[model samples]
Target: MTILLALDDTDSLESRGTGRLARAVADAIAKHYPIWGVTRHQLYVHPSIPYTSHNSCAVIHIDADGGEPLNTALSIAEKTMLDDFVEGSDPGLAGATLDQVAPAVIAFGRDAQQMVLTQERARTLAANLGIWLKGLGGTQDGVIGAMAGLGLAATRNDGRFLQKGTIRSLTGPTPAELLLGAGVDEIMTLDGRRVTEGTIILKEGKAAKACPINGRVVLFVDEQDGKLVAVKRN
Candidate 1:
């Protein structure tokens, strides 16, 4: 079974980034299940929205068999965020079975990318769809982005991975063999050309991140300075 989890607004300006916090949750859950990865979705950014950074949210995909592990994963994520989130920060977590999500919820996510959404609207939709949604602390405004992220994550075109969710981390100029061995679905340039064997992919430390597209883990790149440099996630 595939589980979808979205977390948002778990920090203040000086606190740890939500992407890092989401990575921690994915790491914890991977101890029991196969975590595909966490994806960072950019939400609508405006003065009306009180966001810590980038006005974004993160969604994680995991392979778990039953509701027990899913609940356990949710507990682990909520506890981690509650214990670890910065003071004065509002945090929210949205989770559901991927196969059971409603299409309307995903439409909301698409709208959120371009327009500001309200908490009342998200909660109403979640209520109708019976999706899992909760606010961890503060004013609980994080629920808005958390809900939107869940919808966006269900789509193939919304976000970038925080990590590859493999036991081995890919850093620096990685070879094609390493990427394939680490469970990467495909290695391709930004223009959709596949990387072949014996090719070197120039990645800059942690900045080099991959995005999920069309049900595949895709690392976009471009030719620069005579080397294939990864297009860092924004």
Candidate 2:
């Protein structure tokens, strides 16, 4: 079973991004729970939304078989988030197992990406679904994004991984087997051709992101200079 722990709107204009903070939270949770990866979900970028830069949220995938209670992981995440709370930032935290996310939650997530949503609606839906959700501080608008993140992540086809195993450490050209061993679920070309063995070129100083497609992490690449280079898909 996988637990989706989601966070949103926890940074100010002068502070670090939520993805970095999510990594810190994952570090704390890793003490008790096994972290599968962290994903970044982009929300609606309309003028009505109050966002630091890109309206996005971060979700940490945890394996429930790590032998720790959900509350323990939630406490660790809440404490970590509160400790780094930024002024003027409305932080929200939400979590649930994949099974707990119903169709309503998924609909809410899709709606958030296309239209403006309210904290009250998010809270109501969470309450009905029995999901663990809360607003840590400020306007509490982050609850909307946080709850939506859980739904989006539960779809298993949205967002790109912010961290997955040793993916961040891989640079330059790397073998396909090495990438698969580094927690990449699959490696293929942009046209959906599977790559079983080959060298894939990665950009220097940039963390490689594998997108979730049908519940698997897939690394899509494009051929350049006779070498397979990983494509940057938002």
Candidate with top TM-score is 2
Flag clash pairs in model 1. Answer: none
For residues 14-92, write the lDDT of model 2, one tens digit per residue. Answer: 6577899899999899888789899999899888788877899999999984224567888899999888888888999
Please give, for residues 90-167, the per-residue lDDT of candidate 1 as tens digits.
Answer: 999988888757899899999988987888998998898888899998889899889998889898677877777461
Query: Can you give the TM-score per candidate against the true fold?
Result: 0.92, 0.95
Q: Cα lDDT of model 1 overall?
A: 0.81
